[model samples]
Each structure stands twice: as C-alpha cells, then as structure tokens.
Target: MNNIATTLFLGKGYRVKKQVRKGNELRVYIEYEGKQRCPRCGSENLVKNGKDTKWRKKLHMSFGFFRVYLLFKRQRYKCKDCGKAFSQVIPILRKKERFTSFFKQAVIFWLIFFPFDLLSLLLGVSRRTLLKIAEEFISRVMIEELKDKERLVIGMDAHRFHRKDFALLLVELLSSLPFGLIQDKKKAFMDFLLSLPPRVREKIDEVVMDMTVRYRRAVEEILPHAKVVCDPFHLISYMNHQLMEEKRVIEVVKKRKIPGRVLRLGKEK
Candidate 1:
C-alpha cells in the first residue's frame, strides 16, 4: 500500500488480509512489499515477473479458522553494467518453511520458558523436538558462561523416572548443568566421571550427595582433593529417625520400671 505499511510489515509483523476470487483465477492480498535488492550482492535492477499464491490453513489468533494468503512475487532482474541478471529475493521467510522464522523463534522461546510437554501439546510439536531445542539452548548458554577457572561441583546419582531402575545423572551444582545421563550402574557412572578431562576435574571443589557407600568409594578413588560432603538433609533425616527410636525405647523402659528391666537397660547402655 505505502512505504509506512511496508516498514510496519518489516518491523513489527504482518498478517493475511483476504483472498479475492476473480472469474476463474484467485488473487491473494498479503502484507508484503515490492521486491528490492539482494542483501548480499546489493543489486537493485529487478522487476516482478510472476506471483505464486499458496493457501495455508492455520489457527487464526487463538479461536478462529482461517487461511493464510501468501503471494510469492517472483522478480526478474537485468544488470548489464554489473553483468548480472537475477531475481529479487524475499528473505524474511525461508522456502518450504510452513511458518515464519519469527514464529519459530517465538515457539522456541515459549518452549524454553514453559514446560516442554505442555508447550508441545499446545503448539502441536513432538516432545523430542522440545527437548532437543532445550538441550541446544542450554549447551550454548553453558559454553558462553563457563569459565576455565570457575569452580564446578558435579553430583552423580541415579534417578528413576518410572519402573526402570537404571538412570544416572551427573548434575553440575554451580552452573546447574546436566553433564551426562547413563544407565544406573557403577560401570556407567564410573565411565562418565572418568571421561571428564583433567582440567575439568581439577576445577571441581566439592560434591555433595547422599550416603551411598558405592558413591563414596567412587569419589574417594577418583577425586582425591575434592571434598565429598554427606548431604546434610539426608544426615539430619537419618539422625531424627534414630532419635525417635531411642525416645520410644526410653519411654518403654520408664513405663515398665522393673529391676530386671533396669539391669538389662544398664547392661545395654
């Protein structure tokens, strides 16, 4: 329509207007501008040769059934001075892509911020794709933020999602990054820990975990300098349970106060 309309379409966003039907042909009105120069070659000698219209059925703004009016204005070019003749390109959306890049980015952002399964169901994508996107995003962030000298504490443990008993996780405490996941077995956990480079292992300061004897053995064998702190939460839970049992025993002794009970209690003490 105008330069301002084209600029607005380039800046914020654009949507389909309508599809016009004339006699035996269909013409679609899209919020797009006339063809311009190639971004890389900077050529301006171009003309509109033909147009292709595609009917895309998409959910319209949450609660409506509508079709997308996509008019691909193919351009022809003649640049005898530069000895080049090419077609003017539309660079905003890629060819064969069902959705725009901006729309894909919005979907990715939603997946990163929200829960994966929920967002996948809402956006009509697979959970595997959601997880792959999240993992790639996390890997990029970690690569940017992780420093050579930063202290990294990796906690290794087995986690079970369901009936499968063998699921191991290596979680980096400082960066909150997942190092690796393997089958919940000693050999798998040992291999993962051993696979870390010397420099990375040296950066580790402490590893806090539950009182698993196998884990303690592995830590002592592998990380000599790193402090293995028995998780305070688990320790406190165990101590509280022991104290309750002791309190029950004392209450029983006090309730029966027989001479034989006292002597037996003294002997047990």
Candidate 2:
C-alpha cells in the first residue's frame, strides 16, 4: 500500500508518510526525504521552526474516476547560516499552486482537444482557471517558437464566431503552427501586423490568403517584401462562375440566330 501510494502521489525526492481513504477520496500525506536544506542559502544546518498551522491540500490527477488529494504539513525550517525561515519545497507541486504539476500538465494537454467547459467539469476545476492555464501555456510556446526566427512564410485567414465578431488567424506556413489570433476588424488586423518587429516583418517572404482586398492591402502595406498569393480555392471558384456566365451568353446567341435562319430558308424555298 505504501509503495503504490508513493508511486501514485509522490514524485522524486518525496516519500509518502501516511495515507487515509475517506469516502470516495484518497488522501496521501507526503513529505520530502533526506536532510532539510534552505532553498535560498542551501545550508543543511537548520532547526525546526514549527509545523505549518494549516494543512496544504493539493489536487492530483484522478485515478479511475476517483479523486485523489495530497495532504501535507509543510515543515518550516530556520537556517543557521542565513538565519532565514522557509517551508520545505514539495517536489510534486509548483510554488503557490493548489494542484500538482501532474494535474496542471494534464489540464494543458486536455485544453488542446477538449472544450474548456467540458474539461473543467471533468477535472472538477473552474473554467476560468483552465483558461488561464491554457493562455499562459500558449503564450510561452508562441514566444519560444517565434522569437529566434529570421524569416517566415505566413498564412492568414478569418472565421466568423458570431454574427459581428470574427477571429483572424495567422499561421507559420512552414511549421503549420498558428502564431496569432486577432478578434477584430481590418484595422486591428493591420495593427497586429505592424506590431511585429521591423526586421521580422521585413523577413516575410510570402503570404497566402483568400482574395480579400482588405487583407491584400494590409499585407502590401505592412510587409512590403512579402509576395501575396491568393488561395487557389477562391481563384477556381471565380473562374467557374465566369465560365458559366459565358456559357449562358452563347446559348442566348444561338437561340436568337435560330429564328433568323428559319425565315431565310423559307423565303428561299
């Protein structure tokens, strides 16, 4: 039981001290192993300050639909060298977070494929918390992926999420990863493009988008070096419409000539 509890709830550098099963929830009490050390001063010479007055409860990833909670009394220690007091760092939990790192990671993964509300309900976490996690994760990833690039090829598109609200999406064409989503009109779109670094904007080689005049104009103004390529779907659709109109004109001309031809033939006869 101890081994399973340790493997389930405690990560490296941590050991399970005790576990209690209450109703549907499993509460595993945990503590750090080895000598206590100060985080700031890294001194092993320490004295017990006191046991934390409040129980710190952290939510862990569910096991087979049963909720798991990690309960620990964060031990406070006073360092002799630095004369500073700090609580022992929990290896499995992030600083000042109510959920374990494993639980936060699971939430980030689910937010990619699941609806926010659905994930919140399934994980028993608030929707606002889930959104905040997703936003921070996405922002970090975007900065890391885009910060060092010298050149880029981009694709721009928009989809209507509401009657009057549209979301403009910009994707890196080579990587096929989205870089930006602007929820506004053409003015906002241009503003976003202009907000990019001048060197980065100058590095844009090509932009692929639907044949919207506003988008074309914005790209031309903001990224002077980028060659704008209209999406083939829109180009093909336009050509098909033109071809149908020409076919209709030919049919009308043929109908008009038939009566004249018949009259001439009767007069000759």
Candidate 3:
C-alpha cells in the first residue's frame, strides 16, 4: 500500500504517513523523506521551526471517480550556515508552495474539456486558484522553444475585453495554438511583427484576419510574400453593411425603409 501510494501520487523521496477514505473522497497524509539541507548553502546543520496546524490539502488526479487529495504540513527549518529560513523541499512540488505541482497539472488537463467554474466544482478547487495555476503554466510555456515555425497558418484578431480596452491575439490556425498577444493598436501590432525574424516572416504562408484597412496595409507592407485572406464573418459583415448603406440611399430617394443582403435563397434580394 505504501509503495503504491508513493509511486502513484506522493512521488519518490516522499512517504505516505497515513491515509483515510470517507465516502468517495480519499485523503493521503504525506511527509518528505528526502535530504534535509539548505537550498542556498547546502548545509545539513539546521534548526527545526514550527509547522502549520491545518494540513495543506492539495488536489491530485481523480481515482475511479473518487476525489484524491494529499494532505501535509510543511516542516519549517532555519539553516545555521547561511542563517536563512526555509521549508522542507517537497518532491513533486516547487519551493514553499501550498499546492503540489501535480495539482496544477490536473487543473490544466481538465480545463481543456470543462469551463473554469465547472472544473473548480468537480475538483473541489476554487476558481481563483485555477486561474492562478493557468497563469503560472502559461508563463512557463512562453519561454519554451516553438515547433513547426515554418508551416504556420496564422490568424490575427483584436479581442475587446472591456468597453474601451482591446487586445490583439495571434493564433496559429492549423495547429489551433495561440502564440502572441499584444495591445490592440497599429503600432503594437507592427512592433510585434517587426520583432519576428525576417526568415520566419517570409516563410509564413498566409495571414487571415478581419477586414481592417490598417491591418491589411500593414500585412501587405511587412509580409508582401505572404497571402492575406479576409475571414468569412467579417467579409459577410462588410457586404451586409454595404447593402444597408445602399438601402438607406434608396430610402432617401423614395422616402421609405425597405425590409432588409439580407441574403435570400443564395442571392441578394
């Protein structure tokens, strides 16, 4: 039971001290059985400080539809060599954190299928914690090397988050991956494009975007080799606007509002 628990969830160099099951919930009490040394100075000489009264409950993956949580209190210590205070470095966990690394991984995995609130309720985690975990994971992903840099079908669009605020998102259409985010402005977008390598810019096959005149002009000037295509939603919207404008002009001439491209039977009525 002990060995299985360690290998499965507690992680190596950590031991399961005690375990309990209540209804569908499983709680495993854990302790770090690894080396006791200062992280900064690597000294074995240390003084033990007090620990938290409440056990830190970190949610791991579900087992057979049963919620699993690893409960443990971090052991605080003061290093004699460097005079620095730190906690026992828990394996499968980052330094001094209340939650395990696996907990964050579980949050990220479930987030793909379920929305934040729903996942939070399912995992017994708070929505705020899920958001924090997502932010942490995304920041880590930003620094990693990108793959398939050449074969990219890119899409750029501005997302309005507030009444007056907007953000530009650059998504790889083929892979369905979002790679870049910047302020929604011409200069910000231009700066981002200019920052990319010329070789990469030249290799980009196409850029699909909404029919923004300035955006169209910028892409043409910067990536002249790459083909630019307007997305269908914006194209339809543009045609509808043109039809409305034409109808308004006709109404002024005849003094009546016509019913509504309002595309009828595969052709404009």
Per-residue lDDT of 22-79 in model 2, one digit per residue for the tens?
A: 9879888777665677888888999989988777898887644578898888788899
- Work out the TM-score per prediction: 0.41, 0.57, 0.57
| lDDT of predicted model 1 | 0.56
Considering lDDT, which of the candidate structures 1 and 2 is the better prediction for this target? 2
Q: Report the lDDT tens digits of candidate 1 across residue range 88-188.
A: 45555655545444444555577556664567566665555544444444444553444464798866666542354445556788768775655566775
Counting clashing residue pairs in each candidate, in order, gives: 0, 0, 0
Candidate 2 off by > 4 Å:
34-37, 63-65, 152-174, 178-269
Q: In candidate 3, which residue ranges exceed 4 Å CA deviation?
A: 45-47, 62-66, 94-99, 112-132, 146-269
lDDT score of model 2?
A: 0.73
TM-score of 1: 0.41
Tell me which residue pairs clash in candidate 3: none
The better candidate by TM-score, 1 or 2, is 2
